[model samples]
Structures are given as C-alpha cells and as structure tokens.
Target: MNCYECVQQGRSEVAVAVCYVCGAAVCVDHVRAESKLLRGPASPGKVIRDWPARQLTCPVCRAAEESP
Candidate 1:
C-alpha cells in the first residue's frame, strides 16, 4: 500500500507524511486533520508537527482509538 496523503511513492518527492503508529508514509487519503471542525466527528485534528510524523497516520489505528 502507498501513502494516501502527499507524494510518498518510492522516494519520489520525499514522504511528506509518515504514520506515527505504523511508521509508514501517508498520502492524501491517509493523512488527515486532527481538528474536529476540519475533520468532522469521524476524525479529530492532531497537533501539527514540523515533519512527516505529524502529517501521516494509520486510519485503522486512529479508528480503533475513536471506538468507545
């Protein structure tokens, strides 16, 4: 699987986002805002970091945390 956020394909543009939980790059689809307003009820906004760690994250992992 490929990163869903920025261009993280095989050393192309450099992985813009990397999943904190999985330690993988996240492209547009994988990366998401951590704010409730921006992400809605599904996903909340996380603290924006300076690097990929803050940008990418595993949706499955995040969803597990969201579950009650």
Candidate 2:
C-alpha cells in the first residue's frame, strides 16, 4: 500500500510500516518508531534478558501520544 500521509501531500511513496495506533500505512519519512522494553514471566532458574520491542506510529498519532 502507499503512504497515507504522502498521498495527502500529493506525493507517491511506498509504505514501509503500519501505524499501531490508527492502523495507517506510513512511509519511512512519516513513520515513527518507539522502543519498548519487554519483561519475561517469572520462572525458576530461567535466564531472562531485556528484549527490545518496536511500536510504529504515524505523525498524527505520534503527536497525540506526545501531547499531555
């Protein structure tokens, strides 16, 4: 699919990822990625490490998330 924001600005760009918040297809220029730390479940003698998770968002949704 094509980038929604790019289409709004009259540009044709391929979408790289979908926004997790609003489910909008976004290009690299319009996509925002936030890193999330994952915690594992409690277990006996289990070696757990911090896993990095990524959350994709569009410019509009990112702005909303940043707002108080």
The global C-alpha lDDT for each of the candidates, from Candidate 1 onward, is 0.53, 0.95
Candidate 2 — which pairs collide? Answer: none
Best model per TM-score:
2
TM-score of 2: 0.82
Give the candidate number with the greatest lDDT. 2
> Candidate 2, which segments miss by more than 4 Å at Cα?
42-50
Query: What does candidate 2's lDDT look like per residue over 1-68, in tens digits?
Result: 99999999999999999999899999999998899998887688998877899999999999999999
